[model samples]
Target: MSKAVRAVALVLGALWTAPNTVIGLLGGVAGLACGAQVHWRPRDLALVFDRWPWGPGGAITFGNVILHTGDALDVVCSTYAQRAAPCADPDIVLADHERAHVFQYMALGPLFLPLYLLCGGVSVRNRFERAADRYAMTGRGWWPWP
Candidate 1:
């Protein structure tokens, strides 16, 4: 990705995930101030912050810090994985899957959050998610549902 496109993605991602970013930044600062160890690494478009595992795995956010479990960063983006062990290169299919989410965010802006929440009913969410997964797996087609 060119620097210009990366810059735009950063801005758009920050905007789309503004609420999460604020909470994440505060959490990160608190973690730092309290002496909670943090591991930072550069990823495709953002930084990955490995915090003490509080749950099963990590979460992907559009913010600067992508939180993850101590084991493996649960989140995967275009070409980055958060882990101490050397991770294999990102699979093109998985990358495409995540790219679809990025596009969804771009298309919906802040509305994406509420819409995503509203779509939480298994059937609806699955429709969208399946489309993305299929796109990744097939390397062709667009999301089937709005």
Candidate 2:
């Protein structure tokens, strides 16, 4: 993509996904009140809040924001296995999985949630989650659409 094209795409994607991003920001701001810390993940094109005060220990993505219950994004955050991940020592980054969801949100906008629920709403059978898992592992093919 040319520079101008990429810039336009970025603006359009941000606008297209803004509603969901607003919802994420609400949670992120709440997390802030509860002592969570936020960071920018340029690689994921998202803002991540670490040590969020709710839910089981892991992470969740809403548009371009990721709320994680852990101290960092450098370790495996999924309940599933990632033994072959690219971390230097033990564990691996789970940002890729959530980032996949962010991209999904950008592509589908407000339609992503209903479609996700229809696809099984976060489980082994959910094509969205599966595609995300595949992308996090192999680093490609994050798009769930045929």
The residue-level lDDT of candidate 1 at 15 comes to 78
| Winning candidate number (lDDT) | 2
lDDT of each: 0.50, 0.81
- Over 1-146, each residue of candidate 2 has an lDDT whose tens digit, in order, gives 89999878877887888899898899999999999999999888899999999997788888888999999876865423333345333333588788888888888888888899999886766889878877787778789875
Could you give me the TM-score of model 2 versus the true structure? 0.87
- TM-scores for every predicted model: 0.49, 0.87
Candidate 2: residue 79 Cα off by (Å): 6.8
User: How high is the lDDT of residue 85 in model 1?
Assistant: 39
